[model samples]
Target: MVAERTSRYNFTPGPVPFVVSGGEGVFLHTTDGRKVLDGAGGAIVANIGYGRPEIAEAAKQALTGMGYVAPLWPTENRLRLIERILDRWVPAAAGEAGLTRCFLVSGGSESVDTAMRVARQYQVAKGRTERWRVAGRATSYHGATIATLSVANHDRRRQPFGPMLADHPKIDPISTEAAIKDLEAANPETLAAVILEPIVGSSGAALISESDYWSTVRQFCTDHDILLIADEVMTAYGRTGTRMGFEHFGPAPDVLVGGKGLGGGYAAIGAVLAKEFVAEALAEVGDSIMFFTFSGLEVSVAIADRVLQILEDEDLVNRAAKMGAVLRARLEEEFADHPHVGDIRGLGLMQGLELVKDREAGTTFGGALTPAIIGEAFKRDCWIYPAGSARVPDGMMFGPAFIISESEIDQLVSITRESIDAAVAGLQS
Candidate 1:
């Protein structure tokens, strides 16, 4: 183990810090030679396993061929990647929604911020300048940027910056009626768009909504001329057994934002996909769209393109679906009756265990039990993501690489069960 040290400039140090030397497949190796299972895939980002030589080679080739290019200029790599995302990777459901244009960015936060700006621009182009407010789910998370944080409802992330954020209306994630009520109260005329996670992540792990809820929300947005934005940063690219998370529901979003698995942690990349009508509206009002300096950089685009190719060649999307079932089934069988486990929910590779003080009474631990649980899991040579807030209280998230085997899944579950018991015992002690 490494000793804790503080630096004058270090701002966001982790609770338990360790030095990692390298990773291969689904395990991370520490500098001191300890192997830990990457249960959460580093914040649920690595859909594909680590140490992929092909991806490295692709990036190298791109760097050698075209060192750098400005965002304004188009490159072959960027065009090819856009083509793959539009013609090959996009789900049929998203295609039906008329998503035909792509705007590349650096990461989830930038993608979300850009999407919000695009929504505002679209409304303005349609002569609805009064539509400026955007509604987000009360328990959902979009990203860390100012614009994204303003619209998102993550309590802890928004607590310190409350005064600086816009007072956007927050709707319930699970109830369409609550959303309708809030929208009505906010006055639909003032609302430009509504952003959703389809399957909520971070604040709540893989929290899913009913199909009817999505359908109703979609209808309401369409009827009122409010654009619907789907934040698929954590749920897209085979994480939920679908290319896009919104495909799980009946209706589709007018704009979709994706990150994380898009580059499989091999490159920093994200994209905002707009429907044909939405893009056309923006086109009508020329010079409304802006670009980031690093948007659609050649090397990153090449790496992302190769990642998509690997996913298709190995049929890893289907593997995620099959292995996800195995993982969820094993977790349920092991933890469903555990004393401290309140609920086990999620889709595909993204799963979460809600912890509670009294499972029968549906009571939460009410404090900071998540950090303790995460610490215990680390002690057991496993890395699991901890999720909690004022809304959710406590949860443990899991999103291993799609290549995880049956035996590895069993091992992960066993460690989690033991860690949960150990954590709860520590709390009592």
Candidate 2:
């Protein structure tokens, strides 16, 4: 007999594995002939859902004409995509006041990296040479790069690399209120920018600054001459029902970064949208380039342009809002009475479940319980995101594509409720 080897492990140290062959619409067909609903859209990137023929055709046509181009050279696809993004975010009412320039990148991580770099450079261009430290909130995820890792507050992800990245850049983890005070107290000369995810993704789907938080932060940044960078990698492209998460807030930032669904999970694309002042400051520095790559290729831009068009024409953003409300209502109705479920909250389609260990005391279920629930959920054939560090504890997040159907949403809700029960029962036993 031959030793058995499976294709893909389902995120747990288990005997069984799930091997997926293809996906269309909101359903994933496994190699074992099982079709599981994609509950979380593979970390919320598939906003337009899987297998978009329009995006495919656009990619094919662009490849046939001009497959690749250096980032330094201008291309029609890149130009059109930039215009589309600008049209969506920068309204005629503002007239180029919100975002003045765009820098293209490969993905979410690169988008964060570029924003950090641009912010740092902007400070330098303005003769604020001492301002190098970047600030981010506790538990918010930026990226995996050295600089981004410094900014992100995930202990598990940063622990191994902390020693190596400690001195690379200065990062402060502070609450919205404390951040303002600390910045005011710090050598104001040393602060470059404050980077944050408007609605926190990962780290248990934590959200900060509901209404006035953003407005207050924006005012503080403006008052102190600091740059504000909204890292919208997960929240942009209609994931949050809005075109961008910052729109939910009052004021715009000095720089805005978006990726993930920007290309609708088709092309590897990310972008940095800079305010006119930031762009003008960078321009004054005399040819200071932030990113250089071949990935500003024509094919990616063409595919991304079509993806944006589909999002607009199909009214996927509005659909996400409606479907999100339905899913949340259904979950609230089912699990609101469950003693172990502590909280369920989110914006748009980005939802979460934070389980409690002691229902009476409202104590959280951390450590083994989280992994156990995720493990059981995988066994049940649901692909929701189990996110958080040990510090946050017992978090399961869901952000299905905007194109997810009502049936898919209900299926996801049913399976999630079942999985939670299974995990709770096992714990009690």
Candidate 3:
């Protein structure tokens, strides 16, 4: 059994959570000697899985050998990582659009903030100084940072900071017509950029946009001269079975931000990839983008490079696609007739299960139901992500490691079924 401990901190406002002893592949070993399946891949971050010795070694080497360098200065690991991203990782559509410049940052939030800044700077350089507002989708999350929160529309996350957030226009994620109306209402001339997640994460797990909607939005942005920023922090680096989620759609975004799977949980790192025109405008303006203090750290970059190598060598991206099919099939087979299962949708390994009170009417369960499901799943030795919003009232998300075996997938499904049943039973009781 695990020893209990107390903490002065109250991040969760309860007793300290279980201590994680270690992890191997897709399972997390707790101090209590329970091997819990990392169903959500620790918030969908561990793409390459746990206990990767090669990545650890690369980090060690960089830390011991090169130590530190100013973030603005170039280093061997940083340069190699940039080359890898440009030559191997970035989507073909982005490359064709001349998105060749990369700006490294500490994590997802910083990457998004940097992308926003780049968009504004590009507009300024083009003498469109009045263009400063950014528009985002209503059921989306960019990051926890103030600027990202300002542009994002997640109700719960933004509620506390409403006064602090900038009143950016928000549009419906699925409706291109609504976006057009909102953009026109907000005035195109005052808008610097339009930011969106190719596949919505956190706020509404893996909420994918239709291809036609994406095509329409891309054209509208082009016609209006608004820079398009793709927040691929959760969907980039092969999480969506593609090199980048935007590839599944048309016309690459003017600026792309990536994180989460970029380092595969090996290190805290993120990057902003910009088209040549955007970078050129910034360059011509003679104002370089400022760097994060820990941006391009040798060790972090080295670890990220090694993680990328592992992804390519293992072909984990393709694996994600194949396994995602298997997972979707299994889920449909098990839950298609389930009374509480309303919708199961997503692409690649990123999937969401929307629970409902009335399937025929498409009504959602109460908000508390999702947390109860999360608790039930945790009790059953699986850790799935809970996602909810005004639209997606009760849902759970899953994006396990790409390396998870078929047997593990079976186990995951079994546990999920059991957990859902248990949670529903409890609600009835």
Candidate 4:
């Protein structure tokens, strides 16, 4: 069995949990002959589903051609991907040019690094040496890099690296007035950029601020000459129903960072999109952003191109909106009255549920509640994304593939209900 074959490479020589041999649509085929429903779409990625032959063909075609062009040179796939994103995916609300500059990288961390550095560079190019800090939301998360972790405020992820990270100022997560106060306290002149997720994901379980908060923050950043950046790493490319998360409200951001769903789980690709002015500011000073060695790999670019086209051709973005409503209704039906379920939040296909000790008291059951609930789901051949950290410590996210059906959504929610109950019961005992 392929499951047994994995033991040969375990180093320690032991049987492990079931290994995924393949995936199709909404399910992962395990080596143990189990069809595990991928409720979280592999860490809330996977937009169009898996085992796409078209993506493989696009990648193979690119690989057969000139495979390793230096990122500085614009290859065919690289050019095509940029055109597609700017013309189709970048939100129209961003104006005529609509985030005119696109920078590609290998993955999310690199993308965040590129964005943060670009923001800093833009400031330096404009002779704003005093503008060195980037203000982030109190509960927001950017990525894995030390620089990103420093700008972000996930308490658990930042705990170990506290000594190394520069202390970036943090603003109130949901209140415009409090956020303004935080910004004033941070000394606005020191801020180069303000980075945040339009809809908080992993660290806050799809949390969204009051609608006015985004617009107010945008104006605040503008008034202070601070570049406002929307970190769309998890909410871009139709994951949140709209083409982008910021579309829910607010004027266009100066910079937008994207990842995960950009390649639809087909390739390791990420992007940073900047408004024309931001690029012009750096270019006027003859400064150029650094590129990673593997930035915009032709194979990855080709695969991402196909994924975007697939989303457009099949109208999957709209499907996400309709299916998101279905998902929310299903979750409400199953968990609204459950004692341990505290709150439901999210948009499009990226919904989340918060777990608490008692809904009436709003008391938390701290410690390993998320992992325990996840373990229960896994036992029944389902996989849900574990989410929440810091202030909101126990929550889970349901970000299934855009192509997921009503039946699949029902099954996934049912499994969630069973899993939550089983875990809660075990905790009670």
TM-score of predicted structure 2? 0.92
Clashing pairs in 1: none
Write one digit per residue (lDDT tens) for candidate 3, span 97-141. Answer: 798999999899999999999888889999999999999998889
lDDT per residue for candidate 1 within 166-190, as digits (tens), equals 9789888877787788778888899
For each candidate, the alpha-carbon lDDT, in order, equals: 0.87, 0.77, 0.87, 0.89
Runs in model 1 with CA error above 4 Å?
Answer: 4-9
Q: Count the backbone clashes (under 3 Å) in each candidate.
A: 0, 0, 0, 0
Clashing pairs in 3: none
- Residue ranges of candidate 3 with Cα displaced over 4 Å: 1-7, 14-17
Error at 38, model 1, angstroms: 0.5
Better of 2 and 4 by TM-score: 4
lDDT of 4 by residue, 360-429 (tens): 8878878467878888998889999888787788999999999999999999999999998898888889
Model 2 agreement with the true structure over 1-429: per-residue lDDT tens digits: 011344243354453356678888877777888876777888778888887788778988898956557786778888888988887755443344558688889888888888888888888898888888777776678888887888878777888886776432322332556666656665556778878787777874545454676777788788878898999999887877787787777678888888888887888888888888888888876845556564576888888889889988999888888888988898899889888777787778888877788778967766556667776777887788877764557777888888777777788888888887888788879
Which residue segments of model 4 deviate by more than 4 Å?
Answer: 1-16
Query: What TM-scores do the predictions have?
Result: 0.97, 0.92, 0.97, 0.96
Q: Give the worst 10-residue stretch by lDDT in candidate 3.
A: 1-10
